[model samples]
Target: MKFYKANNMKPTVAALFLLSLLGCIEACAISLNAQKKYPYVLLGNDYGILNENDLGGFSWGFKRHPFNPKDSGGNYWQCFPREAIEITLKDTGSSADDIAWNDNIADLKIVVWVNQHLVHEYGMRKRLSIIDFERRFNKWREIMKKEKYVCLAGDFVNYEHKNENGIDMDIYEWLFEKIKTKKSCDSYLYSCHPTYEAYLREKSKEASYKFRGISHG
Candidate 1:
């Protein structure tokens, strides 16, 4: 084979062309994934499931969750948007149950709900409570962060504020302002930029509706 002049095509020029092609491929892949992620609730629980005993405990935002420090169950992490996640804080002779009438738990159960539908439900032994609580909490937090719907704020009309724990505080606020402005203009839809309006127009009613669900989370 005849050797071509290696210097004729500079390595930097060849590298730029290759980089452009790779960037296009990456952009396409990202779009494809985005389409697959439909609007769905990232439903979760903080030991919030019903039992024969009282559904005990309270959730005052950012306030320490009310389990004793000694109890490992108090410190839990979970992953969610899992369709659903349910945690059973079974009564273990702590303060959760009335023990005078042989009320000790024979078994405790957790039932996870997705969109108000029961998706996963199970009766578990008392000893597994702490381990299960931690696992479920961590799982929910992971998925919630990824989706940005698990926005921690009081479920009020003006959802501009969010839980300080979020990584994208500024982005969330920006989106919040845009949404509020659009609502003020018209309940239908509006955008600050023509480009955004055009992109929103591309989305189907289903996708847009899903986005509304996301905003609430």
Candidate 2:
């Protein structure tokens, strides 16, 4: 979750090719697997969701990934709203308890974060909200070393303000379209457990939980 950092995380494919020529098949394969396997985790404030990662390809709930702990590679990573991050609490989880799940709790929904900043939130009736995608794109494109997180609601749309219907077309563009387009910035959307431990520590204050309002203590 390094933010505003200048390090670049994009691994050059040409380098991968060179490794292949150098007989680094096993290592290269492992790296490629990391790139293809883990990216985002669908998690509420609950820990149970992550435990569901064992379900074959559906193994990204409440999960975490470590990207660069020792900076052996010394690079940056950015998440380009690649996809809408979706999370469901499974009826019971730490998040549910943390917020003191009572009928009066207003059904504190999910949150979206970029560079550890709150972007938007959703509720039971309006269980989803798309962020200002254009603003996000402009802010993140030059980041080159920041990770952005997008959250989604599997539930139907409902909002008290009556401003939400379900999927905001504008938000959809920010979340999906930008993903298809290469981010002008040098960023990488890694998994929950990132390999960069030191950076997380230094930037801990800047790293947003994305599950702030949940009662799942």
Candidate 3:
């Protein structure tokens, strides 16, 4: 597989990102025997079917069966994006449901998984300041240093700065910027675009927009 790097992105970081693809290949090899029965190994929650043509011919398996963390035997980890919490906290009214929702957000914790290995746990209650993000991001970097492969899968809301609900999504931008600027020979970071077409366009100037596709996770 050919890996493309942005003009500003470091070569080492781009190389590290290839480790993620290696992990996917390894996973597929492990399940080769079951390929007839289970063609695809669903990574994240089912959003919808992704067209192969849109993905540069890369196939991530079928989402025929619902993903269950328990069945993964420690391979699967749950991740809660900032948008999920923001949406839940939108109900500021004092209704019983609103109160329960707000309470859940207050106690929310996001578990990050890399190469099917648990890496870090971040709490939503922490201050969303730049300092906190940097500190947490650095901690993740440190943890990933020992790992050869990195695979991150989640509903990273990268379409807009704010969603239709008016919830601020600057967090995703901030995180992406951090990944873009950080220089690490042993660390890896993968930034998902809002759409496959957008990703292809960014990757190559000659990239053609044949069909619209879902955003990369």
Candidate-wise lDDT, in order: 0.26, 0.27, 0.28
For residue 124, give model 1's deviation from the true position in Å. Answer: 4.4
Question: Which runs of model 3 end up more than 4 angstroms from their true locations?
Answer: 1-127, 156-217
Worst 10 residues of 1 by lDDT: 171-180
For TM-score, the strongest prediction is 3
Q: Rate residue 46 of model 3 by lDDT.
A: 16
lDDT of 2: 0.27
Model 2 stretches astray by more than 4 angstroms: 1-31, 37-105, 113-217
Residue lDDT tens for model 3, 1-217 = 1111112212232233343323234423224233324333223221222222212212232243333222321112122222221111121222334433322212222333221212223233232333334454555445334443333233222222334365322222111111111112211232322345655665565333323222332
Q: Score residue 91 of candidate 3 by CA lDDT.
A: 18
Each prediction's total of clashing residue pairs, residues at least 3 apart in sequence or on different chains, is 13, 38, 1
| Tens-digit per-residue lDDT, 160-197, candidate 2 | 22224452221111111111122232121333322444
Better of 1 and 2 by TM-score: 2
Candidate 3 least-lDDT 10 residues: 173-182
